[model samples]
Target: MLASILMTVRKRRQPIIRLALSTMVAALLLGALACSPPEPVRIGFLGGLSGRVADLGIGGRNGAMLAVEMRNRQGGINGRPIELIAEDDRQDVEVAKQAAGRLLAQKPEVVIGPMTSAMALAILPQFNTAGVPLISPTVTTNALTGLDDQFFRVVAPTAAHVSKSAEYHFRENGLRRPVLVCDLRNKAYSESWAGDFRTAFERLGGEIIAEVGFESGQSLAALASSVLAEQPDGVVIIANSVDTALLVQQLRMRAADLRIATSEWAATERLLELGGRAVEGLVVAQYVDRGSTSPAYLAFLRAYRERFAHEPGFPGLTGFDATNVALDALAARSRGQTLKQALLTQASFAGAQSPIRFDAGGDTRRDTFLSVIRDGKFESLQ
Candidate 1:
């Protein structure tokens, strides 16, 4: 009888011991987790990941992703891992606002991109209301410049690029009578660039014979005919790569020997792939120097190709530079200082090919290069 009683007591105690062990294990795990590290620092990315302009948006997103990946590989900002949340704006105003709203809801420290000026304008109000700064890689419309708002960009305004191209055409290329073609789809960028070019070109004693504006889905043949009818010596196209390439082909079909120049908005590799022989001899200005041999740029180029399996174009280079600017400010910010304040406080930040300095209004300027397509490649005119 005593043995039976003792056996029952042992079995009960066995279960209690097992329960204690399980509780202790769970407690130890919780303790370890608590002692590990803080939560990740969240960063939001917005761009047109789909649709016609996906090339620019994807490149910018990839560059931002690369920056985040590289930083996380090393000990992230102050030992906190960075979590990049990317959203596709779809290159539509409504979609961009929705994407921005979603990103803002996540409460990221900062958001990088909406690669074009139109998209930036669409979502700037949301970012401003959320108190999160929007740092763009390639939005160059002059509309956002000199604003004390939350918009900041790594590239200069439209005037910086188009004004230089105008001077180059007038003085270097000797194209006195030039016609302008604008893409109405991205009116913010296209119109801004065209207006600036007109101002500069006219100021240099060059005459603009005609100015034509059309949307992307319009007939290129009719557009080309309209542009050619002006009988101008030179033509400047302000559009995206796909549109630019198609229009160039149309123009080449009619005027093979006419001089053609394009704004930097169309200066992507897609333009070459799509334009082919038609794009040869087409002049353009770009913020990124493809022939750069700087150590920082070369290293970034290698890493980007290895990770993305493609070349990082102007969008990628500028996106990487923009992200680094935000990261630098985040790392150096005082306990209560805002990201904008932190950025403005710094004198300069390191860029892939050059140094980046932001003015009091969060605007930055970089070197622009004039290049012409030679044998299907952009060769610098410098």
Candidate 2:
């Protein structure tokens, strides 16, 4: 009778033990789910991450990604982590449109950029319709940052900037009349810049003594001769910096005494590489100092060299500084809200660059800096 009772007790306890084991397993699963982090704050970087301007896009994304990583390390925004989504626009307009659409579908907090002017123009209308803010690292066309408040570009609008700088260079050098040598028949940068410069110069008591245009992949020595025959006080040449160097070399071959009063884009290492000492007497307007050699710049150069196996290029540094500022804004923004409001509330933003306080229209009315090439290098002309 006692043996029968023991068997019965063991059978009942076996069921209880199984039930307890199942409850423990369920509890463990629930605990793990609780420990998992909240949904990540999504940010997308849209740029020409492939093709010709890939260097610029890659550098910009690096700075932005670094900012996101740093923020995540210190417990993210409102305790939610950050994630960056990047795509290559290939520096093509149609591709930029498709990439922009793809990124917007991900429902990111903010979209970083579509770098070039063409790309920016392609994405602008879509971003405007979606009410999504596109913080551009580089689109510097004057018509872009127009009456619309949504067009926020970190790069100085080249057309307006060149206008003022051209006026200054002309007046300071006492160049009354000038010849407008343009690469309009070919390069996009040349046509727009030449148009803006001609208008600005004419408004500032300067006459266009002669006008000349060239086709892409083709250079003419005769145009330089045409410009010289007019005997203008100085020559205002507008072309893509790389092509500009080729034209300058050809122009210098024709006339040893050519003095230029021109725009900012001409100040790249590309010009010096092609034209060499011929570019020494050349004056240019610059927003960034190539010869900065400051602590921040030096540190950036070192880091860039480490990652890229080379020094930073012109647009690379600009894109780096610009994207980093936006990322800093993201990290410092208020929690529990979309990034747009936080960016709008930022009264003042600072980075390795100058203090960037966006106006209502998101354009900077900043003064232009001048630089003169000396010894095959750039020096700020204060």
Global lDDT of each candidate: 0.91, 0.69
Per-residue accuracy of model 2 over 151-193 as CA lDDT, tens digit each? 6767666665777666775678677777777654223455566
lDDT for each residue of candidate 1 in 85-128, tens digit (9 for 90 to 100):
99999878998998898898889999999898889988999988
Q: Alpha-carbon error at 176 in model 2, in Å?
A: 3.6
lDDT of the structure predicted as candidate 1 = 0.91
Best by TM-score: 1
Provide C-alpha RMSD values for all models, in order.
3.4, 4.4
